[model samples]
Target: MTLRPALATTLALALTVTLAGCIAPAAPTPEPEVSDGLAPFFEQGVDWTECGEGVDCATIVAPLDWEHPAMGSIELAVSRIAATGTARGSLLVNPGGPGGSGFDFVRDSIRYVASADLMEEFDLVGWDPRGVGRSSAVECLDGAAMDELLFGQWDNAYETKAWVTELEAAEAEYAAACARNTGPLLEFVDSGSTARDMNLLRALLGDEKLNYLGFSYGTFFGTMFAELFPERVGRLVLDGALDPSIGALDWFAVQMKGFDDALVAYLAFCVGQGNCPLGGTEAAARSTFTNLLDTVDAKGIESADGRALDSATLGFAIAAALYSEENWPALTSMFEEVAVGESFIAFQFADSYYGRGGTAEYDNNSFDVYTATLCLDDDFQGDEYDVRSGLDAIDAAAPLVGGYFAFDDYAHVEAACTAWPYAPKKQPGMYDAAGADPILVIGTTNDPATPYAWAKSLAGQLESGVLVTFNGEGHTAYGRSNGCIVETVDAYFIDGTVPTSDPNC
Candidate 1:
């Protein structure tokens, strides 16, 4: 139950949009056309009425492919929460899935994520980015297929060609499924197009500037926004910022190391606590966890959940679970429980890492979109040797723990893009965008997902970007905890106050 997928804390390595004219300034493109074929899905002919409280959902068409605007069109589903009370402006919030749903993100966890105060001042905006929830999504491998694949024995017997074959089959099955249900939407889901959609939303929102609050990969969405329209950036918060410079392999490898770091952090916390089952020695627990992985690899364990636990999946599960501190206690409990008599602890971690669909099957979107975005964005070598090298580094960085993190899992994203049905338009600054106002960036020291190094990279990349550090343990900060973090963020939003210096939370 490590939940490192939160990838929020590691982002503290640091701390840590755009524009348009208003008031009848620009001419309307020849009237916008309905996104081809997928128009009905986005317009939601099923529900003519908008879908939320104080919100309206609609379709805005942009070129199916930005590069060939006149040739094709694609529709993005959008939702907006108009300003209530005294309004500051439209604040678009993204919950970092690359595949995550932003539609209801504002209310997902108002108390801990979007502060009540911030909500009152700004009109909350959320959307199911192109190929994500509520928004027309990509679904090749449904839940049941994913469940079967999730419990497979890859982490341990990966040494065998059978497991490698299994992984290859799974990867292909997933890709084919996407082709069946997703059609050409995959081409449009890339971050750059999403940013264009954001601009359109900003225009429709009638906001003078784009006020954005992006979490996890959402940070990249925000950065792209800034680069696209630097003048339109209002108050922006990037939590668990991603390192646009890193390739997918690097992202995966670094994330593995991030988990190791957070795991040690958890061990240190457990060792000192009187209730800690691992006792008060983090180093001992570290050894214990490693030994458990080795033990499970050799002899699988049974959990209360009635599932047989092996090393690979457990490692993957725990690595994912450690992304946020909120998941730490649960992780510790599971590890302790597994040590005692239940192997089901691994299943618990799996459930959290990959939530079930309404049909009781797990969603593979994380695995899918994760692949789509990273693959499309990075120049993946697809060379097994190159990927193995990164994985080896993770393994060396932290023995028993890094193997799961190895970047070789599904290195095909980039490879697939090579044969993508359509051409791709690499954004102007897929990684580097220098010169601009100080972009206040926040990174949670314990973030397991995006990791702190990403924050540092982001700060270093943006000429005017300043790094703000949050000492807490969570996925995204600002509203997650710490009054100081909140105040600093609010100032940036209201007064354009970039931290005079990086504030270490």
Candidate 2:
């Protein structure tokens, strides 16, 4: 939330398949004076026009509010690669971003990463979520402004009353910036609506039950689906599942710890890595990292993208890179560059997280929707006192990255939501999958993004959540080069047979 769109989960068996009847949300919040109701533009209906070779483009017109499918429609962009040889029906795949672009992701990645076995059996379908990517995207702030707000600030301590004051001010600035640019769609862009949109995709695909593979935050989407329509889920792979119940503060704080955990493991690996500067002794790496941040803090470094890298920026870059092992060498190499007085790694890491390249542009659906959903689902206590406590917790959890910065983030999203358009429709049980199936929950022991412990804790909560542990690092377990994890997920999808016991990777 304060950082990125990340992914986990647990479950019990005995799922009584039934759609818990539900109605749509009430009349949409009236447009505020600032609301310049810019009705979105998207083409609906199936067409084979956009696919490069075999893909097809179709749009599903979903309700701006599912309660009133007629009130207004959000056109979800869809892409399909029909079953290559045979048809086991359409297998819908969602890449983890709560704000991830399914259309672009599948169009680009499906052909590359998906195993040939996966391709031959099921038609791959990817759709951009409610107000993300090609599906009525939400943009707030110019690319530059977001780069400033999201990555510019630093120092995690928010303990003092004075710092809390600064946190509020910074949050106000960020919220005001978003409120200024993001339009009408931000109000109704919660995960529930996105879930309904998925169901529509199910209907459009003409599937008796939805066969799905949801990674990272997409796993939460899968969980929401199972909870909303257990009967509809067919051969689901909720990989890298996130526990919806954790508050933003808790979720992010856990993420901070995840990074700390990952950093330790990374350092240990670095000790073995010949070129590791911060390798053998964490004290040395810690000092090197701190000094780099301090150096950048005192005098910013010009990044590859030509943006100045401050301490906070460098810190986020470091955190983002450590999310996966693929990025680990890059991260170490980046830091190694810094160790040698080069700023390119700083720029690269920043580019990876902010998605800023020469050709890259601003799209805040991820940021806006991140805040919109988190601010509500997190169920924050707006009390300044409570915030102080959370700040202490962050500092306690992550002394290096905690204190004011994280606490401010915890309190900030909800700060503007004080006057936000909507309220939480469901109770703050974001992690609860009531009558759900045997959900497979995986977490890397040293994961920096979603963190592993939450996975363990979530396993304890869900009815049939089995915990699969990866004694490694990164975001979701699926995409990483772990053959064991990939095989297990493939098997689960092919034959509803979960591993007899959680395997150690």
Candidate 3:
């Protein structure tokens, strides 16, 4: 809801922290058989050098276009923390942005990435998938342009033709900027291409099969990997799974409802806290939030940096806070300031969501890559009329945040991909991942971004998929949930222990 997973935040921190005191050099993995054209990429040598206190980093080459190998080449940044004990094998992890930096995830937050037992038993590997950070990325507008695109105030009424035209114009300019900046690479950042890249990483790492832990959008990426190479999966754990089979607009509608429900849950908790700034009753708290949005919408609050805090930015601030209950107090604090006409706290949350620095520059190319991959991955169907009709349903389902999710307007369902240059490459469908080893699919009951129903849908779709439910809040379950989830995930990765039944913790 903070766009992607909250863990994917580009908050800069010192990179020298070490999870384990010692590091052991890993024995090189064997190369896998591949066609002559890809042989070089698969057989290329890797030089892992100390990049962090206890982590080694390397850059690998991947084909820019898998269909035509000689088209060009791109670099993939990879990092790993060697197991504290004898390693079972390399366990690849992706922390859920179609654009999240797995390279940063492992290198910076090794302990937060996985449990002690799992890290002790396996070499924890992370990589920036193609079109993400530290890889051959999808660049669009620069910092000032991006800030204007994301936070610039719009005055047109959302449902009007003028609003639709303005939206399309902005996106067209955005798409053109992406094309000008990224060139041919923007067209090929689809999930399918990234899946191929994942397989390449697996072969170069010398792992006979891929052992994966993917969260949120990472689940979609992992599912793509499994579908492409069913027989090559090894103990895949997809937490906060996504159902790629759903259409883009429909998925948006359902996810908005999930976030709305999470907001209600948060309101209930806030009301029970006695001195909650929102209100003493659930209904009162809902009104308090809506009042803040109305107040901000009527007269936008300008931050010291000159960006106006409109309903759109305030809505993102609320959505970002709903990603976890730990962030609930931040939401309360944000409201407390808004109640007094202050914009600083809301800007703090929204800027963090966009990874905007104090200088108004983005820390990473996440938004650019997120847009490219999203538009390229799924075909956003429907015309303006259809989008208007769908908005009715979304608004009906999620009265609180529905308009925000749809840009507070009734434009076409293709909001993000409106003027993108390329059509979607992925045909939404079921992925069985046949013949793969047992795949663990985890779902948190109240996860605002990737809903629990999606996890059930994906698990039911995969042939060897096993569902693990966490009855809790937040976007992901593994490493952050209860002991049952941590132990269940660790046992599967460390000892290949698959639960016979759904451990609905």
Which candidate achieves the best lDDT against the true structure? 3
lDDT of 2 by residue, 19-113 (tens): 23322211221222211232221122244444455666666566686665446767688877777788777888887656666776667666665
Best by TM-score, which number?
Answer: 3
State the C-alpha lDDT per candidate.
Answer: 0.62, 0.63, 0.78
Candidate 1 ranges beyond 4 A from true positions: 1-56, 154-156, 160-162, 302-307, 357-360, 381-387, 405-435
Q: All candidates' TM-scores?
A: 0.83, 0.82, 0.94
TM-score of candidate 2 against the unseen true structure: 0.82
Question: Clashing residue pairs in candidate 3, if any?
Answer: none
Across 1-505, the per-residue lDDT of candidate 1 in tens digits comes to 1121234322212110122232222222221343555333233221113444444555556556655555566556655554456877778888776666665454333324655667677767777777765566666675666656655445436545554445555566666666677887776677888887777667656666678878888898889988877766766778788887765556666766676777778787777665677665766777777778777656657644444576666776676666667767777787777776565556765665555534446543656666566545555534344333544555766565556634234333433443344444475644444444567788878676667878988988876678889876656786566888988887787667778788786
Mind giving the per-residue lDDT tens digits that candidate 3 earns over 15-97?
Answer: 65333332343333565457778777877777777776778888889999898889989999999888999987889988877
Model 2 lDDT, full chain set: 0.63
Which sequence of candidate numbers ranks them by lDDT, best first? 3, 2, 1
Q: Candidate 2: where are CA atoms >4 Å away?
A: 2-50, 151-167, 173-180, 304-306, 363-365, 381-389, 401-421, 428-437
TM-score of 1: 0.83
Least accurate 10 contiguous residues by lDDT in model 3? 19-28
Which is better, 2 or 3, measured by TM-score? Answer: 3
